[model samples]
Target chain A: MSMKRLESRTALVTGGSRGIGAAIVRRLWSEGAKVHFTYRAAEDQAREVIASCGGAVSASALDVTDAVACEAVVDEATEKLGGLDIVVNNAGIIRDGLFLSMEDTDWAEVIETNLGGVFRICRAACRQMLMQGGGSIVNVSSIVGELGGVGQANYAASKGALNALTRSLAAELGPKGVRVNAVAPGMVRTDMTGAVRAVAAEKILERIPLGRFAEPEEIASAVAFLASDDAKYLTGQVVTVDGGLSLLGRR
Target chain B: MQNEKSDILKTVTTVIAQALKVDEAQVQPGSSLIRDLGAESIDFLDIVFRLEKAFKIKIPKGELFPEKLLTDARFVQEGKVTAAGLEELKKRLSGADWTQFEKNPQVSSLGDLFTVGMIVEYLSGKLAATNR
Candidate 1:
């Protein structure tokens, strides 16, 4: 047909080199959105995604934590696509540790890159979103933000702060017609979690009522919903797509 | 714990409560300033200065307020508070009645706390102390 849900939209996804981010970029492009994404140390993966998405998608080498670099990426996207519409903040890094033994460097690095990076990109995108009268922002948080994990103190703190920011951003930008929402994902099969996949997989699977890890596509599906007209009235909400992991305690 | 010193502790507790952005009751001796209260590095710095003014006790410097003190404790490098500084605090306040203040309901801003009057008063006091 004529694309899909996001037709005529110009979108940007940070950390679109691979895994969940790559999946989002592909899905958005399929929906007819002119997509641009950034990747660091994943040049080959970035090129692969751009190749997969064809001419409608553009890939850039940039770090989300660098405010100036993040702005440049947004600027390039808007210039090439004629304007901006949707932004997906999917870039993140994990520095897992127990609170008692965790390193300050690891924690700060994760916070600065994951949480602060979201702030920088969102701040830049909001400027454009405000000027254009409206836009959608989907921040990729994590399931751990809702339920604390041992050895993930840093990750949890960063994600928890992101959830707070999502709410605050919605309040700040809603009056201007811009919507901000967050997606808290469970254990999705991604390259980033490949190391602990096996050991953590069984415990996580048991926690998930569905009894399985999610595919990146599943999380991408929820993101697409939040970024679409279907969720037009929804803002400041965090849609958890962890296959009922969040609800396991009740049942 | 209510006494003249308790009153001083109360004032100090209020300063910690304001700096950590938590209920005064939450600032117990055992309560972690970072983990339990969620204070970050910048917040700890503000708390340090506020503590100095509230208690009028100059912390031993480097030991009590090392820049490394604020790094994330979990990842050591990522967290914002330091072991050396925390240890120094423990030593300084040994046997002191650490009164937890009543948590204020309002979310106070750091920028708001550093008012023109508060800064001028603090500076004047510091100058007088040094001259003495």
Candidate 2:
């Protein structure tokens, strides 16, 4: 916050009304970025996040599943903030089910929102970023992408494809100066993960060497690094922020 | 006609120079985009995107570059472009030179079809068609 690494930078974060996305918005704003964020149906929570930011941060509703809205949000964020320097693709939905009984909607919604939404958002943002000469993009992925969860076949496939998409886009856009990367969180203490923790809190803790779930801020810090010049040389990488849970090899 | 060709070449040279981060003087008419200028597959995508923007024309995928023709089973045998394959390429990309390539026609040499002069000629044709 003191050095203000992101000073003069304008950022847009999706799914920012709660949990990890909220932390990213706060972290970017603290680092001196002009922040704009989106929420699906959390207008109240969005208000609180903006109020808590203690600045002129703006919040809007975006499903991220809507293709046209995905394009519009990027355009709005760029025009409102003057220019876009950073984008965080954090909007994702989880529909965990055993493969045998998983509904078609579960697979379709997870893939469409989590994986396809990133494609749409990045495609739209890349056009603007390319025009601006360069920018940074960070997709909030999950360790389940690398270590597939037993009951999360739909979720797992979505995140795995998301990581691959990140690498592919990085290769395509690197020469143009746009950086693309992903952060695979092990288990962050977020509203989205509340149900998973309620079911297997002790089992999950036993896996992570750190002996606890990550604070949302912990994952946000890693995303902030990738968004800044500190990771300027890096591209096409999946930075795992899982407290060595992945090191345990999915136990 | 001579002045227009020179103008198109100059713009194509600038676009190539910017995309590949090369000196403008190094991108000559006979220079092979990949072999001579060190353009990787990714760099080819960059050059194509920049060319479309600079020329204000949509270069359809696999058109400017004979991507499918190079991969067709009928045209290629043992990694060499067959006589019929050469004919197909000749019919397809009118601006690309086949005079030297006909001598070898190794599938690898297909990249040679994408020369600076070829792109200049291709754009000249595309621009003329659009203007008409």
Candidate 3:
């Protein structure tokens, strides 16, 4: 109908196979951005995401743990898309376990994929963004990062550290015309959360004042807003989209 | 060759003046970009970008500034660049005279090492290499 908000903009979204990452890809594409999304092991799902969007959206396999691979992905995305205007660090993994029982590998895997991955990709993207004059970075954090979860020590710590990184990068890159912000989602209904939702639906719903789990699209909307010109003045901010789940004090 | 060198000097002086927002007269060959023209750390990127556009040549990050040297312990000690550091800089920037920088190699004085004439010499060498 009317002109799209992100018309002619280019974006690179990490972990865009299924769930919240897929939703972000679709939302950014619908808003008129040329989206290049990354997937680790979901080729079929990644293709479906691109096919469904039906615009300038594309998908590539990327393992963000590899430093060289991360740099290559950013370089390829910039070259193919003409330029990089927005980077969405949505690629993250969760390893749920009690603090005592959490294996060293479990903690390292979650931290490397979630937080260290963001560091590598953001560092690469910042170089191009600096050269291009400006860009926006939106990291998908989680509410558990702030209010620690019982079985999610590793995930929570990774997301919590991501929030800190977002703030520090915002301060450093702000003068260079780049903006960095994060979105901390509450309970989003995604493929990754399907099992947990089935097991703990009623218990989880009770804590949320909104009475229902948020759709992936809702998280994507917040990410798109942060990446758009509307949030030009907003940096070093972590916008929580948890349907008031985080508002209630611990009982 | 003489006219080409003067032209390169003029272009470099104009770019530095515009980047530092200083008068062209203040950006002389002997004038230090940091001390005389008031160029700060951040202004280095702006000046480099301007030079790249004006000269249509790519300037590698560490070649002209050698920023990586600052991190190496051999080159910097106790907040000041060691004598070894000045010698390393001399090796990298062989075109320029390093008489003053050799006398005082404090980390703060590193910026003073970057003169308009140094940039002119660097560009001239780059252009000559490209032509060859």
Pick the TM-score winner.
3
Q: After superposition, how far is residue A132 of candidate 1 from its true place, in Å?
A: 0.6
Q: Which ten residues in a row have the lowest lDDT in candidate 2 chain A?
A: A124-133
Chain B TM-scores across candidates: 0.45, 0.91, 0.90
- Per-residue accuracy of model 2 over B1-132 as CA lDDT, tens digit each: 523999999998998887778999999998999899988775666677778878778988877877777678999999999999988888767888888889999999888778899889888888888887
Q: Is candidate 1 or candidate 3 better by lDDT?
A: 3
Question: Which candidate has the top score in DockQ?
Answer: 3
Model 3 TM-score (2 dp): 0.84
| Reference-based TM-score of each model | 0.65, 0.83, 0.84
Those runs of model 3 whose alpha carbons end farther than 4 Å from true positions after fitting are: A249-251, B1-63, B71-74, B77-79, B95-97, B123-132
Q: Per-residue lDDT for B79 in model 3?
A: 88
**DockQ of prediction 3:** 0.24
| Superior candidate under DockQ, 2 versus 3 | 3
RMSD (Å) per prediction: 15.2, 3.5, 3.7
Ranking by DockQ: 3, 2, 1
Tens digits of per-residue lDDT, candidate 1, A27-91, equal: 88887788999998899999899989875699898887788999899999989888889999999
Candidates sorted by lDDT, best first: 2, 3, 1
